[model samples]
Target: MPENIVIIGTSGAIGSAFTRRMSALHPASKIHAFSQSSTPTSEGNITYHPICYADEASIQDAASLAAETGPLDTVIVATGLLHEGDIRPEKSLKDLSAKKFMKIFEANTITPSLLAKHFIPKLNRDNKATFAAISARVGSISDNRLGGWYAYRASKAALNMILKNAALETARRNKNAVIIGLHPGTVDTDLSKPFQANVPSGKLFTPDFAATKMLKVLDSLSPQHSGKIFAWDGQEISP
Candidate 1:
């Protein structure tokens, strides 16, 4: 059967790239793209929906509508918020604030959790299914040796926990559903623009390149790999 894929945060760099990648990889797959901003017009097998990640009603509506087309085999939460107009990651303890911390948690942790809540029901139980969130390597508590961006790191860590919990629950009901957290590495997207100065040549990946690596990793997961965080190259990251 042809795949049915749902991509939340489709207006972002990585999300848009995944949209294109999926369309190219599976011409017959139904790709339902959602974003907080106005997405481009639907064309070919791709359909666009406006969504607010903070609003449960919008997410539920989008998932409900997307489910009408076909059973969902894959759902990717590509939403991320490294910084806004004034909300950048804290460099030290003095830079921390409750509001900024909450904002980070809202985007990194809550968004993907809510996506699973509404869309996991549509996952294919009788066959393979995937639920993946675009997480950062900084999210790994065991791997954090530099330690500076407190809020961003903590929120992603929380997101990792959420992914693990979701994976365990999904396995209890549907052994084939692989819920995971993914690190796209240092991709050349708006999210990484301000920080890309330090990235060495050949290290910064384009959105398309990152998306391709992620697709291959997602395709290779099995029941044993659920509840884990993985890098772009397919190695598992420590929690």
Candidate 2:
């Protein structure tokens, strides 16, 4: 079992669930939870820290602090952005804009990349370790049947490629390291709130349900599973 864990973006619905579920499942593990804004009051085996996704120094500092006790066993980046304030998914080519694309990519792609950059090196070298970022099934080019959400889709696709690259590079240093993406389906969270009306019955999962399933998937993966995307049901998503 993992002895040390780090979870980024624990302020969000899914991220907070991950923090809680992971703590329950691994009671002996030390969980270092980081949030972009609100600092959760530390309790039991879990401790909270403040982080800024837009700043690399903040990420680096958080990583250093988390790994100060020992090399990390698991690092889960549970952050994502679908829509906020004035930004929403594009429905067609005419809806795309440079500003929207940059904002989406910065949140969906760049922040996770920086997390991996700073945290991957903190992974335990002598044992199995996992680094996962929450991605979307729409990011799968082969799985895309609808042609909307260009910026979000492209950003996640780019994030997938970065994971693949990180997997390959990390394998060279630690053969047991696993780096991959996860698709949590249509979770009942703010991120999916706007598009839930079209979702089929029983397709919308609670944050706790998604968290449980994903933790199971993470537990079942091995080194060979690195560089791939897995859904909450443990099915591999084709790129």
Candidate 3:
């Protein structure tokens, strides 16, 4: 069992839901809930840590704190950037800007990789362990059709490459470690709230529902599944 499970971006809908689910399933496990925007809350079996992935020092400090709790078996990077004040995804090349591109890449691409750098050493090599980051289905280049949201799609695609490379290196050192990307589908969260109006009936998932689906996938993952991206229903998405 995972004695230490860390969920970064615990302030977000999916992150918080994942934290609660982990706490419920493995009550004895330590759940490290790290978020930059969330205030610390008292949740049994869950410890909160203030973290900002933009700063390497913050992540290192948080990693150090989690290490004190013991070996980490599961680490989830649920942080993502879809939109922010004055910055929305470009619908066309004319709307794309260098600043917006960098911002999306910073959060979607760099953060998960940075987390892996700090937390990979803490993974349980003696047992099956997983490190997952929330990636988007649009990141799949072959799956692309609509072709909007250029920056968001490209950043996620970049994130997938990083995870794939990390998974390969991780397997060389820890044969039992699974480092993979997850696509949570169109969850009904603030990240998707702005663009969810046209979503088909019964397609938009609740945070809890999405979290459960992802946990099920994580539960079944093996080291052999590393370097791949799985969707909410456990099906693989081609990169």
- Candidate whose TM-score is highest: 2
Q: In order, what lDDT does every prediction score?
A: 0.89, 0.95, 0.92
Give the candidates in order of TM-score, highest first: 2, 3, 1
Q: Give the TM-score (vs. native) of candidate 3.
A: 0.97
Estimated TM-score for each candidate: 0.97, 0.98, 0.97
Question: What ranking of all candidate models by lDDT puts the best one first?
Answer: 2, 3, 1
In model 2, pairs of residues that clash are none
Best by lDDT: 2
In angstroms, how far off is 32's CA in candidate 3? 0.6
The C-alpha local distance difference test score for the whole of candidate 3 amounts to 0.92
Query: On residues 1-239, what C-alpha lDDT tens digit does candidate 2 reach at each position?
Result: 99999989999989999999999999999999999885756799999999999999999999999999899999999999999888999999999999999999999999999999999999998999999999999999999998899999999999999999999999998999999999998999999889899999999999999999999999999999999999999999999
Better-scoring candidate (lDDT), 2 or 3: 2
Model 3 segments more than 4 A misplaced: 39-42
Candidate 3 at 85: error in angstroms? Answer: 1.1
Better of 1 and 2 by TM-score: 2
Candidates 1 and 2 compared: the better one by lDDT is 2
For candidate 1, write residues 53-100 as lDDT tens digits: 878998889889888977789999999888988888788899999999
Each model's Cα RMSD: 1.2, 0.9, 1.0
